[model samples]
Target: MTLLKGWRYGAFVGFIAGFIGATLYPIVISPMINSDYYKQIQKETRAGVNQEEIQPGNMKVWSDPFDRKK
Candidate 1:
């Protein structure tokens, strides 16, 4: 009985640890690993935007198809 109880407790702790690691890896570790790629994408997106022309009401509404050309 004692041996069975110890095995059960160990299994429970192992499962909890695995779950926490899986949850945190995507939110924390993955970003650090891909930080350079993320920075590059951010730079490219910002470079294409015209900062001065962006305003609250100075926007155009598009239809469902969005068939308009620039």
Candidate 2:
């Protein structure tokens, strides 16, 4: 009976921790991990600009954004 009580307590704590983490992930961890492309899209949309107009150019610092050369 005592062993069963310990197991119940452990399961309850685990469930609470998991719920809190899921609730906070988008609020806390999402921005830090979002890609630059997605971030740009969000920024443009919020500014009332057309998303398609915000196209990416060959703007990489160390490499091209294409496979073929001119």
Candidate 3:
């Protein structure tokens, strides 16, 4: 019983730590790591080349099927 409880406690702690790390990495770590890439994108955008036609694997930059702006 004691061994089982210890295993459960270790598993719970490990799971919580992993979850926190995963959550914080994208918000805190990724931007810092990719700062150079982001700067390049900003430069391209400022140069008016950011609106290139989307390719098959690229994300949809914007869409409005309902013509809501008009």
Candidate 4:
């Protein structure tokens, strides 16, 4: 009974290790193997952030273009 339990534990550990390795292998290699994938993603995010940053002060509120109550 004890020997069977030990083998079961070993099998469980092996399954977990294999699952993690399979998942991580692609993520670890993708950025290194295809650099442009991450670069393009980051570039788009930065451009969106910059657009939002610029719009607040430099852009207009056309509804109040003529006058203001406050």
Candidate 5:
């Protein structure tokens, strides 16, 4: 019974903390961050691009760490 009571108290505290965080995020933290910049960049980057030709800048050519060949 004691163990179950402790679990219930923990769960209730966690729920209250999560609720407070969710309610405060938009009002307190959203304006301080430039979230729109990321969205705009996403829109511009995906606007016009050829998928057939892979851009050299986007390619990650690196040897795998697990490879036995030196």
Candidate 6:
């Protein structure tokens, strides 16, 4: 019924808690933390502006670190 009320049960509970946390993170936590098109309008606005409109070296930038460098 009870968990022995010491480090052993605490560790077991902690393990279960961490397991549940890791398991639920992708399902329950990731979606809320992710963003989809939240700043699309601003991005498109920047992208539409030409070099004359925006300064150099600040063009519409999209970088994915997972991809290789140019």
lDDT (Cα atoms) of all candidates against the true structure: 0.83, 0.76, 0.81, 0.78, 0.78, 0.75
Residue runs of model 2 more than 4 Å from their true location after superposition: 1-4, 35-38, 41-70
| Regions more than 4 Å wrong, model 1 | 1-4, 49-70
Candidate 6, residues 1-70: lDDT per residue as tens digits?
7646788879988999999999999887876676454466568777756665555686665557699876
Q: TM-score for candidate 3, please give it.
A: 0.53
Model 2, 1-70: lDDT tens digits are 3553687889988999999999999987886787776879878778975545665684434455586886
Candidate 4 per-residue lDDT over residues 1-70, each given as its tens digit: 3554677889988999999989987889667989998899989888746554567767753465668777
Candidate with better TM-score, 2 vs 6: 2
lDDT of 5 by residue, 1-70 (tens): 3553677889988999999999998887885596796789878997876654555777655558898985
lDDT of candidate 1 at residue 9, scale 0 to 100: 85
Name the best candidate (by TM-score): 1
Better of 2 and 5 by lDDT: 5
lDDT sort, best first: 1, 3, 5, 4, 2, 6
Clashes of 5: 0
Model 5, residue 56: C-alpha shift (Å): 58
Cα deviation of 6, candidate 2, in Å: 1.0
Q: C-alpha displacement of 44 in model 2, angstroms?
A: 2.6
Candidate 3 Cα misplacement greater than 4 A, ranges: 1-4, 48-70
Ranking by TM-score: 1, 3, 2, 6, 5, 4
Across residues 1-70, which tens digit of lDDT does each residue of candidate 1 receive?
A: 3453677889988999999999999999999998998999899888977654774586554356767777
Per residue, candidate 3 scores C-alpha lDDT tens digits across 6-70 of 77989988999999999999999999998998999888777844544643467666677887775
* Weakest ten-residue segment in model 5 by summed lDDT: 51-60
How does model 3 fare in lDDT?
0.81
Task: Indicate the worst ten consecutive residues by lDDT in candidate 3.
Answer: 48-57
